[model samples]
Target: MDGPFANRGRRWPNVTVAIIALWTCASPALSQQVSLPPPLASNHATDPPLAEAMQRIEQLEQTVFELQQRQNGGLIEAEAPICFDAPTAELPTHYPIYDSGWTLRPYDAAKTPFELTIGLHNQFRYTGFSRDEATTIDAAGNVNTIPNRNDFDVNRGRLVFSGYALDKDLGFYANIDYSTVASSSIQPLLGWISFRHNDALTLYMGLGKVPGTWEWQQTSRYTMGADRTLATTFFRPSITAGMWGIGKLGDSLSYTVFVGNGLNTLTLRSSDLDTNFVYSALAWWEPLGEFGVGFSDQEHHDNLAIRVGHGLTQTKNDSTSTDQSGAEQTVVRLSDGTRLVEPNALAPGVTVNAFDVWLYTAHLGLKKQGYSFSSEVFMRWLRNIEGTGGTSLESLLDNGFYIQGGAFVIPKKLELFVRGSAVTGDFGTGSEVAAGLNWHLFDKRSARFTLDVTDIRDSPAEQSRTGYVAGESGTLLRAQLWTFF
Candidate 1:
């Protein structure tokens, strides 16, 4: 009985002590912790819930990220993609029109405008011939003595004025040539009026003395000893043709056509007889890209000249003239019929009525990196020139050809060129070799130095008879200082 009471009293005391300890420590709810989202601010309690603040913070972070992405060149939310730099171009912007973008207003016909562009050009040339001494047969069938070794001294100076009408529709350009070579006088080189139509077409009406080949971009072909070619010197007409036209047709084609007095016959006079009208046409075809073929023709009352040239090969065909003689024979009596002749009739001096002639030219060029090498050949034939009697067409019919080559290298502000040319025809055979250096200073202005030699090949008797550069076959040399402004 005593042990039972002792046990009860001990259990009651332990229960009382456990209750006291719990009350002194803390409440059970208070001891448990609640985890809230990341703190919105350092001054606020992080143990509580703040849903609205946390949502706002999340939105702000997203906005910042989006702005950064856009600044770094990213696609925007509602915009098209963009590039920083654009692509480069490869082709030219505009096509080149031969004589375009230079038209003045107020088109007038009679009252022509004038622009004076004056400059001086000069050159010196020496020609040598081989020595030949022979006897000549006169009209009386008599033989005569001859001299040898003749040379010629030549000098040239020119003033040029070329421009367009300032307030009119007409265009005029002229050059006055002063030289010791030919009849010394200021001769007009180019004077024409261009009628404007559109961007690609033009009509030129006036005097035309320009050579068929002198209009090429390369000036070397035309600048032969301050003139053009020897063939042009001998066979070309003066200001006898008129009503010419030239135009650019397409991106790679151009043409020229004219109706003029081809029979005006080139002379040193300002006016001549209007013998007959001649028509000329030229067409250029660019088939191989940078290479072209040029076809030209001159038709006169009783004569015709057809020319064909190649841009790449620099070669031309000059076999247009054909024999017009028939299979027949005839007899002739001289004015002084002291002697009668029944020869083959196909004699050297017989004259025919009319014949066709062809001229061909070809060019071979090596162009690389601003350097150029080129050559040309020109040939012509007189198929027939028969008149009547023993005075046959042979004396009237003339055929000739020429060959030329040149090298243009070391291009800079100043350039150097060397060229050689030879001409052979019924008149005689002559050659020209030239070396030149030029300095380009400003617009259409340049200074140059040129040296050249010319040779004439003629029979001993023929040269002596002419009394020109007689019977000497060699080259004459010359030095010249030239300028064009």
Candidate 2:
């Protein structure tokens, strides 16, 4: 028993089908002229109307099939049979859409005034740190010290909120960090508002990272090791409130320029910021295409990829209004880990209150298959020392370099690396040797377990990330579970 919509292809002619198609496209009213039968199941086999409608549907299908055949592999969709349990309620005009990736976004384009995307990152760690003597003497005869640690903690946990409003090209970002080092402290890590003029330019202002070195710019979640190299910690600038210009010249060339308050002005009031400004910039070219935003050959590039970059920072530092004990913001320190602001730091009876600083950096990176290599060199010059009391001073020069390479012994699953760095300056010298491994859990960099062992001698860098205490000789062991949600 054939229904009204059964196949009856040979009854329809080509010319008649063309005319009907044209009439349907003329307007909505004309398009609905050919009515389709409804409310009849195929089991209504004895109904005359059902049989007629079935014949009309078969003719339509043949016409559509002929049109589709004229194109190569193109599809013309036909009416679909509704599911038996499908909901009959119509969709609302404005409904919230949910999306998830590294971040979770929930908003509606029609009803919401703005968009909001939330992201989270957690790094849990087991740090086993030991130092030789746990104390050392600085160039100025001041004793520096650090405590040994064997601890389990959430080293860094971050919550981020960001999205666009008013204009699609205008955006805002905020990152809150819960740091467990020193003491459990919650702080606002980054906050910025940006306007993108086009693909080539974006301008932002607020508190964010000042453009520094290539490794310093890489997202913390993607470092080649559990932390950055010691040399980077020794010379890199600190986060500050500032404005920046970030842009891409083309697919391979990119740059960032920033002007901000003195380095590590996090604890400083606006009144404490002097008229002088800290300025820095970096630009890199990936001649062989994207070298990736982070270290490692995680993507396993089949061809050679290379990137070279140069950066410079210039500033006049005045210690008059700064807190002498802000450990993270003490950007200019003697190689022996003596703060430049300390009285009699360079000579007896002389105190350094102000100084001029200029830093230059160059770096290169290469990646291919399951291997990668990267290195950077730095040069620093300090002059124009201003102090209380008559003082005779000479220019201070510091230089250092770090080289690191890695290979994926098991492709994306397991990787191992070795790194070495040193610092040479007017007061003293420091060096570090380290080896590390990353086990990408489930082959995802977004979730990985990292392990690293490092030996240090008179380390010039002092940062909590690597648990490097200034002016100390020590060995460190770290194991971390890093994940992004």
Candidate 3:
């Protein structure tokens, strides 16, 4: 076991030596020079000496204070600099900026002056027709009968690619269809390039849809029903190579003009120099605000919106005849059997002349909350229509009209729609009614399923012994799936 003095020597050695150095010093200057010895062991006989040492230490306390004061300012500074090296780290390489549901963008998209994005739209449809039977009486009191037949087929399959380039100043769209009932091959739908000068003006050129009425210009993918109304189908030009200009005059006004190959012709250049050219123009105005394209009531506007529009298309056809007949004759005829011209019956050489056709259209649209409604009327006139013997055709006029509307029953998820169309002309009078329900599975009309039923009635003059129907009345049912990505 260690004694108390040995414990003190271990625990308080530095303190005891510091006290002894101060006590043995005689003057303030000598106190700085004094050296302290290590602590010593103690015994009972040495208690008197330890007591003397403690008394001497008490007396030298004042001297130790003076010695500290006499020394230079007591300050210590680091002899060298210190530094720290942290571990190296890397930053993320990829970053995203904008996501507008229809476009892809990069981290620096705002700064980028040019970009291109790819997209696709697809629709698969099945249509079924119901048979009908009808009886007709002729002028001689003869009883004639006609019968309709049922038919079903895939209607459309389209793939599209669209994007903006050159800092969005230039835009491009292209599409092709794989479903063809008349021909077993693919078909080109639309391919166009546009140059946008500003928000108010844009120029387009290529094989694309013609600019006519709202129903004609609106994309089929976004229509409320499974298909467009029969009035629009009969009057609207399908596709053509053309140059079109579209622009906004203000927040509430817009206009469009197009000059192209005549009526649904897709030829880049006409083989016949005398072929006709088609010209179309349209102007629209909004009273309460902008009424957008498409028939669905997806916007649910807070205020009532109204749009009114007018459009016109004019064309002149010129065809040459090589017939050797020495009498006036009709060498060219429209698909509807309208004679192009009455040639000089007495002349023995080729003859050529031009005829004119004019189309006029007016439309209106209204929308509020989850309800949308629209209507359009069309009139067509053919000039200089003559029979083979130069006999003038009577009342070479045609007219068509349609009204359509839709309401979202479940906000954006479910919708109900109805449409009716009527046409009157030399080919006879025909009418149709269509009703449908649209179930939006994803984003509005971007992904949807639809069911539609349509009924048609026609006069005897409109009956054709063609592909499907041979009667004056019929019904059709359709189901469709549409999507975009």
Residue 484, candidate 3: alpha-carbon lDDT: 69
For candidate 2, what is the total of clashing residue pairs?
A: 6
1-485 per-residue lDDT for model 3 (tens digits): 55766546443653575456545443434545665453454442356755565544543553443334323222112222211122111211123222323344322334444444445566667656654656643322334465544444445566666666656678887777666343534677788999999868899998876666678788777777876776666566556788999899878889999998766564334554345567999899997877876777687778898989999987765434532221111322222222234233112232334446787999988888889998999887767643343444443577889999998898878889999887776545667888999999974667889898888775222211112221246786778887766
TM-score of 3: 0.67
Model 2 scores what on Cα lDDT? Answer: 0.75
How displaced is residue 13 in candidate 3, in Å?
53
Lowest summed-lDDT stretch of 10 residues in model 3? 82-91
Instruction: Report how far residue 284 has shifted in candidate 1, in Å.
Output: 3.7
* lDDT by residue for model 1 (67-93), tens: 333433222332333222232122112
lDDT of 2 by residue, 1-485 (tens): 37753533433343354455444333323332454233233433564754575555555544433333322122222232212132222212222333332322222344434667777889999988788886787878877776788998777898988887766678999998897873437988889999999868899999988767777888778888888888888888878899998999988899999999867776567766666788999999999988886778988999999999999988886555532322332557778778776767888867776678888999999999979999999998888876665353788999999999999999888999999999998888999999999999888777989999999898888877667778878888989999886
Predicted structure with the largest lDDT when compared to the true one: 2
Cα TM-score per model:
0.50, 0.78, 0.67
Q: Quote the lDDT for 185 in model 2.
A: 78
Best by TM-score: 2
Stretches > 4 Å off in candidate 1: 1-116, 124-156, 166-169, 214-239, 263-274, 285-366, 389-410, 413-445, 454-456, 459-472
Cα displacement (Å) at residue 216, model 2 = 1.1
Local distance difference test, candidate 3: 0.62
Task: Give residue 172's lDDT in candidate 2 (0 to 100).
Answer: 95
